[model samples]
Target: MMITLSLSACMLRQASLCIPGPSRTVLRGIHQSGARCSGHNRWSKIRHRKGAADSAKSTQFSKITNEIYLSLRPPASPDPALNPRLSAILAKAREVGYPKSNVDTAMNKALNPNEGAALQSITYEAVGPGGQVGMIIECLTDNSNRCVSRVKEQLNKYGGRMSPTAFLFERKGVIKLSLDPGTDRETAFDTLFEVAVEAGAEDVKVVLPTEDVHDQVGGFEVITPPSEVSTIASSISSPFKVIGVEVAYLASTPLRLPANEEDGAADELETGEGLGDVISEEVADKVFSLVEGLEDTGDVVKVWTNVAEV
Candidate 1:
């Protein structure tokens, strides 16, 4: 005699099992298979990639929101026209596709004096892996001890250590302006060069649009004295839109890295021994990881490195 047992559909679905009468053939088949289907594996990979992307976007949004709050602190006005720094931060938020609601929320928090404790700004200097790259991390937090501890932890975890790296950098104002579509690059550069110089700019260079800069066909980076940042940005005329303006700690002497082993080998050949200044790709990756980790920390607002490029 064959015995029969009935299982509810809900129970079977919850257990990811199929029961037909009293037969165990389906269970045996699944057990023999052992591994999941290819479709499931593909879906898992896609989910993981999406998770990483979402995490990056979240980090960016959080940083921008913090910036907005900081920009509205005492001595800074809620009106963009009165606060150039706030204006620049808002422009950055829009460029990154930050939601308008979030911006308004940050502003509201800033405007309320009792919303939270006053934020204090701090800067931490460190040397990255290989001791070739110097970094300056800027942060704003209500608790200095907590912020410092977190920064130190990230630095230690990523092969970096706190040290005096500030001497490697100089404070300067950086303004990035995008050229209007159909505008002649050369003409715009020439016009901006003259205008920037007249507005006390230190230097102006044309930056060709890249994958990272999708908003314009081309742009110009104007370096100025820290106090002249807003003056220069406001001085820009039509055909050029100011995209970013900030007082930044720029590397005084950028540390150049070899693009490949061949380049390093060539440098070593030129010198009697291995080039002490050049860092390997592995070390560069570690430095980049350290910077990313630092930026991900809640208090960290900006991270600058002496390394030219990665």
Candidate 2:
């Protein structure tokens, strides 16, 4: 009887996956499968993957909450509309699908630390495989020791080690903008570049993945001296909308990961891909896994690395 009921649930789940919107009759037929068959192993696999994804998403939201809370620290107003920096951070938080309630809770915590344990920012540096990858981990944690231990555990697990890698990177402001599709490419680029340069921006270039290219100039990134980031971002107007603006740790020297020449060639042949792409997808996946592990630690706020972003 127990097996029959379990099979019924699995059949219902499988039926739901097969049918975009399973009707009442289809659902009833799914229940009938329990009487004839008990084979539904795929349900366990599907459930496991869903559970893992939900857990990861939960951890990510917690980290974002810490960021929202940290952004609301005293001297900065709890009202995002009144504080430009906080407003920008809030916009970023919303872009990432952060809940408004969580944002409000974070603001409340910031306004009243006595309501909860106060959070503090901490930075840790680590060197990745071949000392080729350098990372500056920025964390907001109530318990510094716990954050340190978790960070160390992730690095050690991923064949990385903690060290003084901060010197390897320079702080800079990075702003991402969305360009208007109706505008001329050359004209838009020239105008935004001119505006950024005048505002002390060091460089400006499109930052979208070529593999996901569209007809229009979707967007671009602006790099500036750390202090000038906000000054330049605020100056960008009209055709270009500011999507993201934040201080970033840019590598002083280029990353020297072993080029996956063979994979690159294969990918290009298969999909017309180009060069200067990050270390191969496999290596990038591994690096991302390490990064995700660090982020999963509740204390970690943001993880930055020299490994090229995909």
Candidate 3:
């Protein structure tokens, strides 16, 4: 009798741990996947490490350097206090492990027009596989032809084509903020929304905890009109770490797959049984590969796409 009682208790305990209202197969799958219900976990640690390494690499360093140079281009003072954008870019450069010497050199070039090559800003649009994905590539280069050629070459190589994606993507101001450790979620969100609306923001998105949340650096994504980004970002009060203030290409609508190409079953939606999507791992990998190929171009700084994660 005691043995049977103990077994019942054990089964009940395990059942309680399973995601609410899912079958045993789902529970088993979650277990096999090694997913955790809580925010802090081994997966989170791995993601954080990967993000740090990626940010400190050559491409990221170059991007930050360009940002610093461009931020100082308005004939504004190099003193960060005088140019908030300059301050933000410098902070980013330092965060990415860029050398202080390099930072100073870039600033000097920006300050003295004759000191460096004249670089122009260029944007290229491309359509990805099945015209389901759209991308906008922003580049700062001294040679326009070289930049365009490089971009076109990459697009052709990756089954993408140069086309106008502006209709699909609109430029919006994005302000990202990271929630401080131990902060109350409700309070933080309330404060963020209030500040954003007051400062002319259009929408606020809570960066949902995802398998990639482990890789994400920020906790919230705030959006506003292109002209209002800086003002809105500056108004958000502290305790929340403001990550970046910039203009980005935000998709006006999602790109949906045809029924035959649709990945994953309706049952897998919000199952909490896995770290990522219900889509077969193969499709997800292909999508990311296409995006990464575009971003890897020497002159490509930012690549925005409308590809929806399945």
Please state every model's RMSD to the true fold in angstroms. 22.4, 17.4, 11.8
User: Worst lDDT window (10 residues) for model 1?
Assistant: 1-10
Candidate 2's error at 183, in angstroms?
2.4
Candidate 2, residues 1-310, lDDT tens digits: the string is 0011232232232233221233322321321111111112221222233343224667768866776676566565666545445666777677668888888787777788876776788999987654556788888888898889999999889877888888878899878777776776457766775676567677655432222233124566777787666667778887986766667897665342332333332122112112132444445445556766776688877777764221
Candidate number achieving the greatest lDDT relative to the actual structure: 1
Candidate 2 Cα deviation (angstroms), residue 196: 1.6
Give the alpha carbon lDDT tens digit for every residue of 40-88 in model 1: 1121223333343225788889888888876676666788876666787
Query: Could you estimate the TM-score for every candidate?
Result: 0.73, 0.68, 0.69
What candidate 3 gets wrong by more than 4 Å, as runs, is 1-56, 73-85, 209-218, 256-287
Q: Report the number of the highest-TM-score candidate.
A: 1
The best-first sequence of candidates by lDDT reads 1, 2, 3
Q: Over all chains combined, what TM-score does candidate 3 have?
A: 0.69
Per-residue lDDT for 75 in model 3? 58
Model 1 per-residue lDDT at 103 = 91
Give model 2's clash tally: 0
